[model samples]
Target chain A: MNNQKIAVIDHKCANLHSVIKALEIFKIDVKICTSKTELKDIDGIILPGVGSFDPAMKNLIKQDLVDSIKNLTFSGTPLLGICLGMQLLMENSEEGSLNGIGLINGTAKMIESNEEDIKIPHMGWNNIEINDNNNSRILNGIKNNDYFYFVHSYKCIPTNNSEVAAFTKYGQKICAVIEKNNVFATQFHPEKSGIVGLKIYQNFLSFIEIGK
Target chain B: MIINKGNILLTKRIIPCLDIDKGRVVKGTSFLSLKDAGDPRELSNFYNNQGADELVFLDITASSEHRNIILDVVEKVSSEVFIPLTVGGGIRNLDDIRNLLNSGADKVSINTSAIENPDIIRKSSEEFGSQCIVVAIDAKRNNNSWSVFTHGGRVLTELDAIEWAEKVNSLGAGELLITSMDEDGQQKGYDIDLLKSIQKKVNIPIIASGGAGNLKHMLEALTIGKSDAVLAASIFHYGKYSIKEVKDYLNSENVPIRLI
Candidate 1:
């Protein structure tokens, strides 16, 4: 596991320090990839994002990484997206006018609540209800309902229901975790979610090892 | 544990605030008369281990000359601690917000600057997502109403507390950290009336700050005050109660808190 290299893509829209720090806790080799050249020979790729959708997509295009990342996944390299990174995996978002990476068939929509008590940003710790049939390796030891830290205004809506691994309720049944072939993403910040969140990173690493 | 029951139940956060001055954590009464607490990194680690949902570090003396000192503290603590960290004090513009966020601060709280230039909240939030911009409002009782204070509570503004809460929310602040000057350091309890009024107007989460002397005070801040989170310094910094003790108390009362 120590010899395996994991590349975290830097699109100028996120603070990659925490993600790198989280991955380093397991003694794994982590690198920040800005362009396609830095992504060569990587065992796994992590796309961590913050900020808006259009700017995130624009940053990927500005770095000339869109094609490289898309091609890398086509070759069966495992990819994991976090927060805005998860939304970038969808086809597009209502927050902005840019097209997403199209890795998953879905659209990102604004989370609205008619009740005044329910906030819009949906910030704080909330538990997830794992899909009973979800045997995804990324959720290996995670329980059915465990709290994880979340801070976002938009929720991902994958077109295929089977692709969703977990869901959390706010005003509606928002997708919290999604697992498709060679791709896994979470709408919450696992790096800031504490021990249970650390378990998620551990499970992702173990999945990478098995793929090798 | 809060049963899902097909509903999203977000646990009310119990946060330990560390007021940093000259690179050391300090606590004070009504934003004056400071006393040393401990090292920022040590206390942050202590809180994280005790299952604190989040942490807030306010640089009480956030002068231009001492800016780098707080950045250094944020860098060191964020490297070791995993939970969300919010750093406030002397945040003047977008560059200040960017610098803190780049240094690993999950959120940046601005009070004086936001009052000085209300546009900063909108600009900063637009540049770096609303989830990272937290507006800290210092309120003092003015007869039957509350007036907003800035500059460590030394300067008072003409803006009304309740109205300012709604204005900041419209300006794109992700959360509000409201510190009541009247009840701060008094140890009786949070200013329930102040929190209740602000919580009613804003859609963003409100963190009740100041005047937390015991566990029940913290509970009142969450339940009656309707704050999404509670921020206390003296109680936690002085060892009056550990975070676990408070969580255990709130848990028994069924407040839906995160218990490790």
Candidate 2:
């Protein structure tokens, strides 16, 4: 396979350094693309976001990166979203009044805090159960019932049932992962999930390599 | 006190708190006569490899070393260990939180600052999300109840422990790290009463800190005390009990935990 570069889109509202550090362990070329001009000559794109929804979306728009990101993913450039970045791939969010990139037909809804005796942020190591039929490429070697680090209040609800790649039971059956063609995302912070989390970044880079 | 939420059980966390002074991991008896334990990066990597759920770095000398030194430590530890890292001590403003997060810290815990200016908690949570903000409360038994203590548990405050837990939770603190001054360094066990009291009032996750002698105390904190996670320093620092030993004991007690 030829050499590949992954663009980690920096919208100025995320813990981008951790994500970059995680990806760097795989020995793959990774760059933090801050503007649309920097999106050129990249095999894959990673949208890692934190903070609130409205401000993150506003930062993306202000940097003129929304259109380029949408185009890149629409053209089948493998894109991976982490945490709030995963939430922004949907149509809208309950966290704030802002339209998402509309890459997937879903809405990022708040995890019902009153449903059970669970924490709001769901901050801990919760295991994931993958759907065997649609084994996501990003989860190539990862086993079922493996734990990943999660710190989020909202989950993505894909309008299409087939988009669900994995399920993690928090207060209820929360959507943990989504995979639609070249677009993949995880609600958990694989960067902060230890050695198992680092395997995820490695797998994604290999996936991009194979696709290239 | 273990609430099983269905077939899926949330793994109980075992956190090792490192009291860093001048970039070196230090643990003292009652926070005095500090002695070097190990290098921050080396010890952090060891704990991460030993299956520590998360790591907490409290800069005991933050006021003196200030930003650059601790930021460098945080940067090194975060790069070496991939698990969630929580940095505490000397975080006074939003920029402190921003800089720590930018330096690769997963979360920042504020104790004295949060008590002095509660707006800092709200503003930090507002700017960087509650998931990355943790409030540390140092409490000491005051007659029938516990009072909040500040400045390395030197000065006493009028704020009630239970009330402060509720207040910070309302202000958008995702987690609470409550350390018991009376139980700290006793090595008998955690302050069960303090943990039970605060756990009853807050819906957010409570990390029970101080007073861990052995694996059984850690288990008791999780079982009888009903803490979401257990934080200890000397036991792990002085080579008394390894993180794996405590986790193995908790697992044997039927507490669901992620085995490394």
Candidate 3:
């Protein structure tokens, strides 16, 4: 069926350069899917995004692809959601009145600062502290304090603590990477993160080499 | 002459403007042509290593009424490269400015607030020092003079671009990133006349942007416009040229730059 190994859910968000470029670096082939009609034969998936929850989820609904995502996770495909994509992994979001894919039981909340109120849509690069026991092959060659790019004000606070794989602080310990069994997601853009980020794509490539 | 590969600070930086929307690198082709480009961390790192000199990630989109993509873009890039990073958009008071600086950015650029509240220039300079705070002015030529545009070039403010440049200089802005909105993404060439006007107005290092099409465009921005630096987008993002090649041309022509 000419099934590509990776599928990047387009969903009308910009910045696929990071994901596409990273996958290219690792020699991993990726197929873009802004709709459900295109994701059927993909071996593994990467939901890369940047934008609001409501509109993004709306796009997903518009394409009627939410169920397909849920079904794919159950079928044991490795799925990784980046940044806003990570927020979409949750059940609901406060940013724009919308419900996420509900892959993980959590609510996306704003990071509160003790200072004279921190400017959000928290901009700039910071450190990520990995904190999970997930043995998923996606993180096989990963390390701690490996910096990844971030650009969001809201984060997914997993209702199920076991869902979190990593986190970074912006006046709060927000969820960074969430892995629930075969479905995994990261709030950071590994594509834009240089070397360490390259390793992530490499690992993902090896994890979902399209066998299952 | 395109020698240094990823020396973003050197090659007349061809920064791809990332207007972060909902935590993604929203590609606004004509300034509002919003399209998702994947993740910021991956894109910024790729651009940095791929030969983009510094990156400007604007958070507020000209108004504070929407979402911010600062922490997300920052946390991703700094971990990826050792390149210089400048963040702007929706920066209001001094606190917002300082927070960005402390977050691993080499500099912070301010626009709307600088015009709305002139005090911001002085206060940010006093605390973070002039070099850390970059005053970003987005302008469009109006009638006989150059007029400043605020909020992503959506509003035409009463401030004159050159006059604001001079005042921004006096307020201790370490550098000035002046974007010519009328010429942005046109890829014809730089706004030499406008840059020349500002060059005569302010002494701070200027990053001339808008209409950088080819090597000659960058050369014109530096030699004719007398701008200290040049910035562009399409040429780099589309792989038309490399930063190393641009800097090589500049250095070959005796234009001093940070060669790595």
Cα lDDT tens digits for candidate 2, B1-260: 65453554478899999998878889887776678899999899989889999999998885554546888999888877899999998888998888898898989999999989999989998888888889999999888899999988888999999999999999999899989898887898899999999888888888999899988888888888888899999989888988899888888788888887
What is candidate 1's CA lDDT for residue A206? Answer: 85
Off by over 4 Å in 2: B2-6, B62-67
Q: Worst ten-residue run, lDDT, model 2 chain A? A: A113-122
| Highest-lDDT candidate | 1
Question: How much is the lDDT of residue A60 in candidate 2?
Answer: 90
Off by over 4 Å in 1: B1-8
Tens digit per residue, CA lDDT, model 3, B79-172: 4554557888777787776566546565788988889988888887766555567899998888878899987888998888989899999887
Decide which is better by DockQ, 1 or 3: 1
Report how far residue B144 has shifted in candidate 2, in Å. 1.4
Question: B123 in model 3: Cα distance from truth in Å?
Answer: 28
Please tell me which model should have the higher lDDT, number 1 or number 3. Answer: 1
Sorted by DockQ, highest first, which candidate order results?
A: 2, 1, 3
Candidate 1, residues B1-260, lDDT tens digits: the string is 23343343588999999999989999988777889999999999999999999999998775678778988999898888889999999888898888899888999999999999999999999898899999999999999999999898889899999999999999999999999998889998999999999987888999999889999999899888888899999999989999999999988887888778
lDDT per residue as tens, model 2, A136-198: 888887888899988888889999977888989975888888888889899999998888888
Q: Which stretches of candidate 3 lie over 4 Å from their true place?
A: A1-4, B1-53, B56-135, B138-260
